[model samples]
Target chain A: DVKVTQSSRYLVKRTGEKVFLECVQDMDHENMFWYRQDPGLGLRLIYFSYDVKMKEKGDIPEGYSVSREKKERFSLILESASTNQTSMYLCASSLTGEGHNEQFFGPGTRLTVL
Target chain B: LAKTTQPISMDSYEGQEVNITCSHNNIATNDYITWYQQFPSQGPRFIIQGYKTKVTNEVASLFIPADRKSSTLSLPRVSLSDTAVYYCLVGAWEDTPLVFGKGTRLSVIA
Candidate 1:
């Protein structure tokens, strides 16, 4: 079984503070993704990394960035946390190639920016 | 990426089969249909995926017709634990950054 783990399950931060959400996968997948889930809006992609040091912006990438220094770890960084950034953050990893896009997700971290 | 439409919510009882259907009218040729289940406060879990016809797994089964415009997820003898939100997504094999819409919420009662 693929195991995806997150550094925190819940977090609270004040406005304009810097926040980091870490994700690690044991399957050594080549693709890692960060998403935020909000009520009524569903899940929106924030950022994704295809390989080490390679990152791409998704639909909702404002105020957020990502780091993939190693194959097993991916981190999401908020430059300046705001109240609007409060959401349930999710991390997923998947193998690259055909018929291999099935992403394994970690338990999300619910971040509250006050 | 193809847009998917599913029921907002459903109700079922234990020991009964639950079939949730999703519609993707604009599904492309290379696109595949995948289903996910998400419990409260947890990330979504992959359930099944299929291009056409029937594909069965240990947890659920996916049935897609020839037109590929829609798919049905069949959960046999559902239990209370099966209660969760089911999301249906359609995308190409190499499409990065998946898009998930508001999923169907299934509430199973005892």
Candidate 2:
């Protein structure tokens, strides 16, 4: 079994405020990802890292950035949060050894920016 | 990642079998179809994955045809807990990242 934990469950922030959402995975998975979930937009990728100190922009990575300092931890940073940036942030980790099918996800942090 | 298309929502009763089909027009030979179930306020969980023919696990079964243009996920004896959004993903080997579709929202009524 894999356990993915997020730092926050609910967050509220005013406009132009900076926010940070953290995620940790107990399983030693090489691939980590960040995604934002909206009502009608579904889940859009923010960023992903295959290895430490490396990052790749996903479909929606304009307002968000990611940091992967260690193997088990992945963090999402919202620089100057806006109302539009308010959404459910999800972090996922996958075992890259040999071949893997699924990416385990965290509980998700719902961030609201007013 | 191959683009996938499934129904927006579905309605089913308890103890009934629900089959959600996904269409992938451009599925490659090496691509595999995977399914994920997601409840409200939670992330998606892996359900099943298959490349060709039938693949069954303890929770669900994945059926794929020979042409590979489409795939079906079968859930038998559904309960109220089965109500969730099910996503269909077709991942290509050469594709770096996996793409998840909008998914089909399943409603299990009593």
Q: Point to the candidate with the largest DockQ.
A: 1
**Model number with the top lDDT:** 1
The weakest ten consecutive residues by lDDT in model 1 chain A span: A38-47
DockQ of each candidate relative to the true complex: 0.83, 0.59
State every prediction's TM-score relative to the real structure: 0.96, 0.96
Q: How big is the RMSD of model 2?
A: 1.2
| Clashing pairs for predicted structure model 2, backbone only | none
lDDT of 2 by residue, A54-105 (tens): 9999998898888999998999998899998878999998876435847899
Deviating ranges (above 4 Å) for candidate 1? none
Positional deviation of residue B81's Cα in model 1 after best superposition, in angstroms: 0.3
Give per-model CA RMSD. Answer: 1.1, 1.2
lDDT of 1 at A70: 98
